[model samples]
Target: MTTVHERARPAAEVLEWGRATVDPAMREAVGALPDPVRHIAGYHFGWWDATGQPSEPTGKALRPTLTLLACQAVGGDVEAAVPAAVAVELVHDFSLLHDDVMDGDRTRRHRPTAWTVFGTGPAILTGDVLLTLAVELVAAAGPHARILTSAVLDLLGGQNADTSFEQRDDVTLSECVAMAVGKTGALLRVSCTLGALAGGATPDQVARLGLFGEHLGLAFQHVDDLLGIWGDPAATGKPVHSDLLNRKKSLPVVAALTSGTPAGDELASFYFAQPEFDPARAAALVEQAGGRDWSRERAAQLLRQALDTLNVAAPDTTATGELTALARMAVDRTH
Candidate 1:
């Protein structure tokens, strides 16, 4: 495992460069949308508030970081990969905008969600525009337009599976993993592949980077489940037990549900009960059923796979250490 250096300045600088690439392209693209849609997009990304005042505290821009790092790891000029990085971040934000609407989430980054403030219609339309712009950003670059569209379809399908899981207690762990691969993994996976292609990587390197992204995405989602249930509100920017309150049937919950333990049976009862919330007992039950521990171990394993794949593809690069360090930091993040 790469040491997570305590020095924050260097990582911040890399992330700032990543954001610079993403923000300008995003703004220019959103500017092409109708005024109402543009405002929704801006507000969602925390460029402004509902009333158009400037704001901070947007998302972490993780996808673009992965994009840019993959480019550099493959010995490509970071500047050449800027357009693809922007495209990756745009697609990610588009997904988030729609996800908030579909989940009826009222807040994000400690601020009101775009759908809540501007209404679902505008928020959804903004997502459509962002998706279109994502395509346009990568069009001139000429790598994976069809692949990007397919990823969107995968995202939609994954979201559908997630929503459908709410009504069915029969969800297997395999099914849950597959749904996650489609919903979250596909986007991250392709971001790496596209970045490598932009960097003039060969087909083999592209596949390796894509695999690394896939594993990283899985680890990320599993860690997200942990945060949803137990992360500090200040760090996570959401209320504790948010997943429990929502009964989200996330990866860990599904793992516990299918564990076939006595605790699993008890956990199922709580999930099916009306007025659904018993945070303390729910936490205990999941722990007793081994969901929490299982998820933690699985996340660690997936992260290892991501790093191993990265090492295989790009044995030496000026940016390899940064890529490894960032990948590890992503899984370790509280949020």
Candidate 2:
């Protein structure tokens, strides 16, 4: 049994490689920006110190690792997938910046969020710049161009759906699944598709890989929901019960509320009433509703489904071993 810490070590190394590619590309892009725009973008990507000179810490770069691993799983050179990997990660970061603003989240990865440090206007522009960078990088990938554009469209659609669900009282599980597929799953699916595209995989092979990534992404979200409730603050780099405080409509909360337990009823009633976000009350609600356990079970099932699909997609056991390891690590992650 690989511990989450153990799994994260290698993923960290993978992230470093992706990070190496980003800074140089960012340098090229930043030079093209006007002075004030340049400063904001530089700070956002961690290329500048608070005083605004060169420094570093471009964040975890997890999505890029997924992109590279998908490429390798299809026997493509990881180097060939660098453009796509960078694009995906930049897109992910863009979402994170905007999400922080919308959620009123002041921090991320233990540092002030872009919007918190820069003003909301600058942070919004910074996110827009990153989105443009993603598009430009993806466009540079030539033959796989469509994958990038499609991912962008899907990402926007997902974000819209996620916001729409927040106000509605009657969101179903299936609807949530669709939203997840678009929001979280879309880029993940594209990572695999980009890999196949880079590797010159057959059309059928590309389709299967997309399906594999989609399932893995669904499982990833399930696990994330679990951690948001139960994960330790030290390990996760956020306050415990951050999602509860945010009133995020994640998988576990949805499942528990709909499951018909006494705890569930209490939760649903509390949620409908829109009680103030008290950390103690939120934690109690999660415990009472068995949200954590329900979410863990769902994550396990989705992981199994993902593995089953991978078996069909890449029959060569040796070829897919790394990717299989990554899939297991994703669902089993604590943070």
TM-score of each: 0.93, 0.86
Alpha-carbon shift of residue 272 in model 2 (angstroms): 2.1
Off by over 4 Å in 2: 1-9, 21-34, 53-56, 277-290, 315-319
TM-score of 2: 0.86
Q: How much lDDT does each candidate structure score?
A: 0.84, 0.74
> Which tens-of-lDDT digit does each residue in 60-175 have in candidate 2?
66566666666666677767777777778778878888888987888776667777777899888878888887778777777666777787788779788888888976677677
lDDT of 1 at 139: 85
How well does model 1 score by local distance difference test? 0.84
Cα distance off (Å), candidate 1, residue 302: 0.6
Q: State, as a TM-score between 0 and 1, how close model 1 is to the true structure.
A: 0.93
Q: Which ten residues in a row have the lowest lDDT in candidate 1?
A: 1-10
